[model samples]
Target: MLVYFRLLSESFRFAMNALRNNKLRTLLSLLGVTIGIFSIIAVLAAVDSLDKKITKDLSSLDKNTIYLMKMSFGPSEIPQWKREQFPNVKYDEYLYLKGAMTNTDQMGYQIFTKSESLKYGSNTVTSVNVVPVSHEFIDIQGLEFDEGRFYTESEANSAAPVVVIGNEIAKSLFEDSEPIGKKIRMYGQRFTVIGVLKKQGSGMFGNDDSSAFIPVNFVRQQFGDNNKGLVNVIIFKPEKGVDMDAYKAEISQKLRAFRGVKSGEIDNFFINVFSGFTDFIDGIISQMNVVGWIISGFSLLVGGFGIANIMFVSVKERTNLIGIQKSLGAKNRFILFQFLFEAIILSVIGGIIGLLLVWIIAMILTKALDFEFVLGMGNILLGTGLAAIIGLISGILPAISAAKLDPVEAIRTGM
Candidate 1:
């Protein structure tokens, strides 16, 4: 063990002396390693941030709840025939489905309009998404109220002109004043704010705290005709211990019966288990990570090539030095180990610098935005591993060339 440590220390001292003698060349060689490591670290940090946001967004939905919507959740596009078969589901139908299902815990309907500019006094917030939904939506989406109560079913039934504002919306408009009971105008209609929601922050879809919630029935009455009660989607949770597969089958059977679809006829609706949506999100994030690595890998390749080129130059410059070492009883293995260690050290230093750079960037991002950096230990280990592998592989030819130099001929030559 003492002998190994001495050898390692000697090799390190020799490597440092070599670097000091040719500072410019050493810096240029390390530039490649620096850039390569930087690419990997930056890409990883950004990708990790995006993944965190996506996961947080998906978590808004309960995994046990089933989502019934017009669209499918994945890359498999729904066929035109499927679209043709499934007509718009009406609000009355939602009531019937709710009544028919024995094992459902809760259900909600949602209809959304394109974002609009909202005005309170002189402050106007533009492109704020408005979701007209029933009170059940609050519970389904796991919302918390900051002030006042959500619109009740009776208020929705009566088409009562009440509104609930998100924290951001309230902040933008009323600032410090209580938003509750204040009147705000959206799309030229004045609605009284009944509640202000606690801040939920941003997600993959959009900012959850930048929208307004109103009664689904009231929204339908004002913006929709006979289709006012027609729902865009329905969400429901299953009873405890109920097998989702069996429950799904029963729901399918019931939907077919309710929609009056005959045997062999395709049903006109789409259903999705929450797991499917989460899986789709995971798939997207995985694909993004793969793409990021591929791009960063190209940079690493360039860096590796730089290292190899520099090592080749080093071999030429130190041919006489290698010859002297060989003449002094140094073995070819020792020469190879020395050169390899130098290259590995260069890469590792670059990797550490790159990691620090990425961490600073991530911290800046966290401060400028509401997101948190998610630099898992796995990413750190992976970056370090990649650097070591590149150094070893790129150093091989140079190490071998140095090891194979002819002592007499190399010492006789000026170079």
Candidate 2:
């Protein structure tokens, strides 16, 4: 151990002297390593921030709730067959499911139809999303009204033209006016506003406060196709003590029966529970990990090659010093360790400097992007390990040549 420490110290001293003598070359060699390490750190910081953001967004949904929808999470190039496979869920079927389910505390159906233009006085907003929902929608979504109450069941049944505006809609239409009792026009039809939702910011792709709410029947009357209703999603909160998996199984069977699917046939719809969404998110993160690691590895590979080139040049420059050491009765292992240690120290220092740079960049990114930079012991260890590996591998051939040198022959050749 003592010998190893002595050799390591000597190696660092020799490597520093060589670097000082060839300052420009040393800097050039280190450039590749710097860029590679920087890329890795930047990616880790950005991805970590996005991960936290996604987790926060998803946490707003109750763990016990399940979503019944036509689609799943994560980007897919496959085109959706929204109309053919899963026809829009009907209002009667939603009611039937609610009545039939004994394992749910609350159940709600949502239907959304977007009007391209919504106007208040002279100002207009385009591509405004309109959602029509039952009072239970709030319960299932775990939402509390910020202003007036959610519309009553009687209002929903009577197709009352009362609307609830989201924060953005309220701001756009009413500005400073008291939004309650105010009227807005969509597709030339007028609706009275009864409430306004508080601001909930953007998550993933869509903004939370991007839609206006109205009673289900009102939406059906205004926009429903053939009076059959076109429900987009069904959300349900599980009752206490009910096993979610069992509930899913029972619900699947019931829905299959309702839809008249054969035992051999796959159900056209999907059921998304808390775990399903988490699993989907995990899959996406895993893919990102693959891409990140691949890019980082490639960069390290290039840096490793640069280190090898510099080490080869270093061995040639130090040939006479190696011969002198051999003449003084140094062992081959000693000479080999000297060169290996020098290379390792150089790579390690470069790695540390790169790590520091990336960490600072991460901090800047976190502040600018509103993301958390998750730096820990693992990342530190990884950077150190990578540096050592690059140095050892790059120095191997040069160290071997130096150790095998014949002192007499080296002196006689004098080159």
Model 2, 76-172: lDDT tens digits are: 4435764245666667767889988886889887775555566889878777777778878776665556687678888888988788877888888
Q: Which 10 successive residues of model 2 have the least lDDT summed?
A: 74-83
Pick the TM-score winner.
1
lDDT of 1 by residue, 343-370 (tens): 7766766677777777888888889987
The residue ranges of model 1 lying beyond 4 angstroms of the native Cα positions read 10-28, 80-85, 225-231, 367-370
lDDT of 1 at 10: 72
- Per-candidate TM-score against the hidden true structure: 0.89, 0.80
In model 1, the worst 10-residue window by lDDT is: 222-231
